[model samples]
Target: MHPGRLEGRYVAVVGPADDARDVDLARAEAVGRALAEEGAVLLTGGHHGVMRAAARGATAAGGVSIGLLPGSDRAAGSPEHTHLLPTGLGELRNGLLVRAADAVGAVGCSWGTLSEIALARRTGVPLVLLDPWDLPADAGVVAADAPAAVRAVVGLLAGR
Candidate 1:
């Protein structure tokens, strides 16, 4: 790694969109806000639930949010997203999302989220888990909340 700063880096927040819980949504939003405050770009699935919440937080913080939509219609993504890209890759877009991120923060548990997490780990990307599935210690750094997750990601990205 280059030991670059977190600013201008892309950090993807992966979690359940349709099946997201309230707590996860809140944590995702906070994580988005914190990342934005640190001058990082936020990326999401670009739909509802956790994605929308995180996008909203990024927007509120005057930060850019890029949404990668699985559908062909860009309008299908959340309006909160600053930029929307329609991949038409369906579930396979998860790989693209994970690959584009300099780091990843998974806020909740879902099949889609798991895929993203696995992709990040496989690619050697820094990852953080918040209120997510139970995994081995080496899987990812478990954070108690959003701020901690963002800090951990920054640390990892900074090669600290």
Candidate 2:
């Protein structure tokens, strides 16, 4: 990878869209902020809960936030998102999110988040888990805390 490879690199932040705990949302927001500080473009499912929090953080930090909406209505996406792509693919859009990202950061545990993680892993995209699910050691997923999420993701991206 180039020395400045992380700059403008798209990193997807996957987590619960709804019913996420306050702690989880906070962690995701911090991860988003850190990624923005490191010059990463934040990408999410583009709805509520953790996604909203992450987008808010990225935008607040003067960074770009992109959302892949599950529905055709772009207005359904969070206002914090700098750009919204209405895929109209519903949950299946998760695959696109993983494919678009150079690396993925999982903030919280959820069925959708797990699916994203699996997709990233299967596609050989580096994954950084933040207070989330655990796969086998051989899965090559990087485990990190909320504060370390960006660094871990950047390291993975650089390795690639």
TM for every model, in the order presented, reads 0.95, 0.92
- Tens digits of per-residue lDDT, candidate 2, 1-160, equal 2433468699999899777889888988888887887788999999999999999888888788999998999999999899999998999999999999999988878999889988988999888887766677755455557767777787788767
lDDT of each: 0.90, 0.85
Counted clashes in each candidate structure: 0, 0
The candidate scoring highest on lDDT is: 1
lDDT of 1 by residue, 30-87 (tens): 9888888888899999998889999999999888999999999999999999999999
What value does the lDDT take at residue 81 in candidate 2? Answer: 91
